[model samples]
Target: MTNRPRIALVTGATQGLGLALVEGLASRLSPADTVYLTGRDAGRVARAVAGLPATSAQVRGELLDVADPDAATRLARLVEERHGGVDIVFGNAVMRIGPDDDPRALMDAYTQVNNFGTTRLMRAFTPLLRDGGRFLVVASSLGTLSHLAPVLHDRFDGLSSLDEVDKQVAAWRDAVLDGSAAASAWPGFINIPSKIAQVAAVRALASQRRDDDLRRGILLAAVCPGMINTPTSALWWDVSTAASPAEAAVPLLDLALDPVDPGHYGQLVRFGRALPWKP
Candidate 1:
């Protein structure tokens, strides 16, 4: 590893879980470490960075929209130039749920941001993620196998490659557009399916990295922080029983900071505990 400080990046960090994760990470940063807080809006990124508590490690803000491949590439280049490489990447950026009346539009929006956007980031940043690094995808419990149709669940559970997962997501998108998603027993909501694809992609990446002849030693994981009461979530859920963003971020922080355990690779973590993988 280079003598430069270890680096961490969190996307969509203006508010809610992303912001909370940034705060949790700030407290744990070593003097040599630096954290980058990124979002689509420059103004929001600045405000979020300014509000963070003082830390030993430097905290900086950058503008990033995960949906843009050029933006992902630019961020990767910037990190490589400044820090040599990143030690941790928190993929927290997500799209808002659109109106259900337009199923096609809704599916397209979620797929772009939640699925394809994630693929872009992973592809761009994998080269820049130092050996023995961590890539944590912020997923949700709604993506669990229990929520999918049996056929879809089997396909996801048996995923062997990222390409296969990508194909599945594409198929789902096509199904939605053709109005055959319900016939396939797929849920109407876009969030759950999008997250399901995200988790599967994470699993595929972890498996690929581990089996590669040139191992990167990157630990990949998908985490569900539960129903946190964030501004985005507040619109749909009652905040009464929902955990605060800070509270929900605890488990994510633990996973990011902790040593890479091979057993946890490719796992879906809920509140810091790894759930059993279905064969």
Candidate 2:
């Protein structure tokens, strides 16, 4: 049997880092292998798939809005039916807004997409992972636990259940909506908390499913791709010195395609190095 994975999927692959991830996977996999380039926008997904080189792995576009509760599940079912299972799944979809936007709106959007979206995708796809498969949450350095207050440490560390994470995330959201988030030590910017929740979800689910993971050789982690010059990043800060999407995608591709290391599972990784969750 060939060593190359037969199926790979990347979400939010319409542009920027997501698009580059699709490119990297397509180039790396054999022509017989398939890479699904998914995004919420049908037009964008179709265009992104059309633009990829036909000489590489077969690239197919699918409309996937992670925020929609049923979207990930539907795709998972379809993938399992067609491919039997998937080799790699990159949860790269996220929602971020400019600092000038209303804080409440940002919190709501971020919670739904970045937080809930991640957990939903994990639940849907984790079971479909083939042996030696990798499921990655495309998080960032901001997702680190150090960004959270010291008081919140134990709530996230070595979580044994996703429900524990959800309760904490919901509490944070309540703090935000009640205008007490800042006073309560939740980050003023909604992105940080949402990312923290995303990472926590990954950690929790990885722990919760350790038995199945070990049995199937599945690997899970939240990865930081570093600062990339994408349209979204350009909105909040000057990305003049930031890496291009292609450059940022390299480390992530390495983690997804390289050999699985159990040590890296359930951790926050940057450039193949796992970062400490605690300060």
Candidate 3:
């Protein structure tokens, strides 16, 4: 049997879903596979590395603030230099701009960090990702089905298409560019505020990468880890009793590394179920 484990890179690895991903991979991956846990805080990174059990799997801690323009390239280089090529990239980094924060500045930062971060990392290390390598993008249900609830049934179907979604995205992007931060739409585009920006980022990435074939996204997905009772979901999903973040990560792993799944490039899924997203 092959002893090599699948090498992976996970952003925001200091805690939450990222941390869970590392733990899960560490437990299951082959002896030779590596998992690089990246975080903005050097201390947190070190702590996380030290905390994990030392076993056959290789674990490396690195300083990576995905919001930092340079961090994207830096991480890619580190992965390439050390692991040769990362087989799976779990993009688990994202943020919510605060209410007191200046909307314009924060919105720009969101765009630059989330959208641009994904673009830069995926582009810089195209060679590092193999043709069948998986690209798991952690997104929200609000961004996928909620955005398309007005028109589609299977939100997963539209992720691979843009004709319908382009109009909505273009309108919103234009509104933002025009400084009309208040622009509105039926699905309440800006009404929900920063959340919309994250969805836009996912769309922009899918559109841009669909053509070059630079890397076979295989399963470029935006997933809603579900109403896990995490600090972030404490406000909205309280009634549901958020499942352990570690437990929520299982679906993501199922969609990403499932041996039976052919692939789900440019697809949207939540709780292991695919949905429509284009419109």
Candidate 4:
């Protein structure tokens, strides 16, 4: 192992799974590593950082709103300046803007935060991510092909590169603009489509980066934490079946620190199990 310090950055870490992920990562940090916990709210970020267990790895709070493209750019620059590069990146920030009544409006809002924002972050940080590093996107099972219309599902399954993923997302946006999305069999839940975009992005990135990842020992994948008892999920889930944020974070933390077979790359992991994307 290199003697250089390990750096980790987690977005939307003020509460819920993000916060739990921060804590879990901090608990395992060596003295040479640092975990940066970020959120839009400065006070909330401070509080979350303060609550972390005392550990050898330093925990710092960063103010960031992933929805702003410039913010992602700045954060990536800041990490590069301070640590030279990052070892881990968790794209966990997401927004469930509203119900599906206005499909266009809901689509726009979710697309801005979950899809566009996440894409911006990955673009900004991928350069800063070190070889052999891990990049985990907090995706959801709702993003699976089962929830998509047959045409859209086939398109996503056939994605061969990141550019194609962008094209597919653009096509969906056009469909939404023309009122075709609502008429189609695509699920009405805005979160599902947003997550579908996120997972597709991860898959595309994994494919595009395959050569580098294999040569450098990097791991990239999307993970579903299940229905967690967070403010976001409280909207629909029954309290009894919902898992605590800490409980849901278990798989994420595992993937972050463990050394896995190269086969794990590009797969969608749910509850610690890697599910095949293709039949």
Candidate 5:
């Protein structure tokens, strides 16, 4: 919102929603702004940066593997040194690799990068974010509660606690190992939305702890781009039936650029609509 032009750091920016977000922000910049596109792959990050046009003198690439604590530390230090401060931080990396068909393995990688990686990044980068800026956590709607679940199920469970949800995940693993899709449903902890919300909570809290005045100025929220047809969907939200990356990027951009918050920080939003993201 400042005329000085904002500087943003977007993770997982090499493709899909992350890729589209950088493009959207780049197009909106007035030459005074800048964006740092980061990904685990050096070549991909470079290619993504090079493909953008009219980007502020600021759009560039940095290699960051969120799953690795050391890499995250390096990127955080580098950004703080280079930019002095970061105006926006977009958490959008997700792990979707699966084959040779190991269900537990797939879930392990997914949880590691999408959940733990985001948490680790928040811990390291919160200091770099200027007070009253933005931190958008990108995730999905699956984090909601389930009707069949108990009263405590999550937004994904329709009702549940983290413990119960974790148990459900273990159950699913058992079923998979036994070649039975008939296993009881997974506890909602494995739900993507809940995990994303958990990570974004840290961002919001970290910002608040840094500056008491940040209550109304900073916007830290979990945003679900909503079934974007990216290859990472594992064919669940098929590319054909969902919004394109560009289309899904719009709401997140709104949350990022909105200078004033109508609500408090740590709100989880989706598709321009604000919904409760099970805390």
Candidate 6:
């Protein structure tokens, strides 16, 4: 790592996986560093920061709603002004809805926060990342290309820019909204496509920024923490045997703080292994 003071940020950090990530960063980073934990609610953000264990690293909170198109850019500007640049950023803010929920009513909001909102965060903070920085998105295992239709493989695999990814995701969203999605052509869970879009954005950006990332020692990857027993997981699976957020956080922390790995850049990773885009 560079000698410059490290500054990190985690969005949706009021509780569960996001909060656990904030705690882990505090424990791992030196006292000289700072970690910003953000949530939509001011009270929750304040409480989350206040509840963290005493650690060498400084912890603070900020109010952020990833769904707000401008919130991320505003925060990015603030961080830039205060610290010059950011060292680590985790795109963890998300929305979860059950299969029974009304897709017509919730689909737009869900896609907005989980897909477009995340892409916005990446765009906003990536420019301010310092040398040797790491940009990681807490995506899901459902994001694997194997979950999508075979016909869609080339489109996702060939995505070379964020705009292309956005267009693809928008096409998917438009199809769902228009009731034109062929049955079984996509995963039933609405979350899958959103996750896929988020991971694809990582790949596209990684490709776009390859030279700069290599020159500056920056690493970018989307990680699947897997079946964590958070409220989000409870919506779709039995939590009896699921890993707690803290346990799931172990590998994620390693990915965030470990030495930069070129092989993992632009890949969707699970347990430190890169998943094949097309399975």
Residues 1-279 of candidate 2 have per-residue lDDT tens digits of: 137548999988999988899999989889789999999989988888888765478888898998898999999999999989898899989876886788776676677777778888888998888888889999878887789888877766777777788788888887888888767767787778777778888888887777788677778999999889877788888999999999999999998878777888888899989988778
Of the candidates shown, which would achieve the greatest TM-score relative to the real structure?
6
Candidate 6 lDDT over 160-202, as tens digits, reads 8888888888888877777776463866567778888888899
Overlapping backbone residue pairs in candidate 2 total 0
**Who is ahead in lDDT, 4 or 6?**
6
Query: Would you list the rank order by TM-score, best first?
Result: 6, 2, 4, 1, 5, 3
Q: Of 2 and 6, which scores higher on lDDT?
A: 6
Question: What is the alpha-carbon lDDT of model 1 when measured against the actual structure?
Answer: 0.81
**Residue 150 CA error for candidate 3 (Å)?**
7.4
TM, every model: 0.90, 0.94, 0.76, 0.91, 0.78, 0.96
Where does model 6 exceed 4 Å of error? 182-184
The local lDDT score (0 to 100) that residue 91 gets in candidate 3 is 80
Please give the RMSD to the true structure for each candidate, in Å: 2.5, 1.7, 5.0, 2.1, 4.9, 1.4
135-184: candidate 3 lDDT, tens digit per residue:
67676666644554443333223343333333444444456766763443
RMSD of 5: 4.9
lDDT of every model, 2 decimals:
0.81, 0.85, 0.62, 0.81, 0.66, 0.87
Residue ranges of candidate 4 with Cα displaced over 4 Å: 98-103
lDDT (Cα, 0-100) at 193 in candidate 6? 80
Using lDDT as the yardstick, the better of models 1 and 5 is 1
Q: Residue 131 of model 6: what lDDT? A: 89
Error of 6 at 18 (Å): 0.3
Number of the top lDDT candidate: 6
User: Measured by TM-score, how close is model 5 to the native structure?
Assistant: 0.78
Clash count list over all predictions: 0, 0, 9, 0, 18, 0
lDDT of 1 by residue, 1-279 (tens): 245578999987889899888878877877778889999999999999999888777888999998776899999999999878898899999888734347686777768778888878888887777876788889887767777776667667768777888888889899999889867688877777888888888888877776541255677888899988766676777877899999999989888877666667887899767875543
Cα lDDT tens digits for candidate 5, 1-279: 456667888899998888889988887766778888999999999998888776544688989988785877788888778777778889888776433445544665655577667767766776676756777777665544322344334422321233333344444445544655334543433454335334334433544453443643766666767777766564454468778889989878888887645453555567666666443
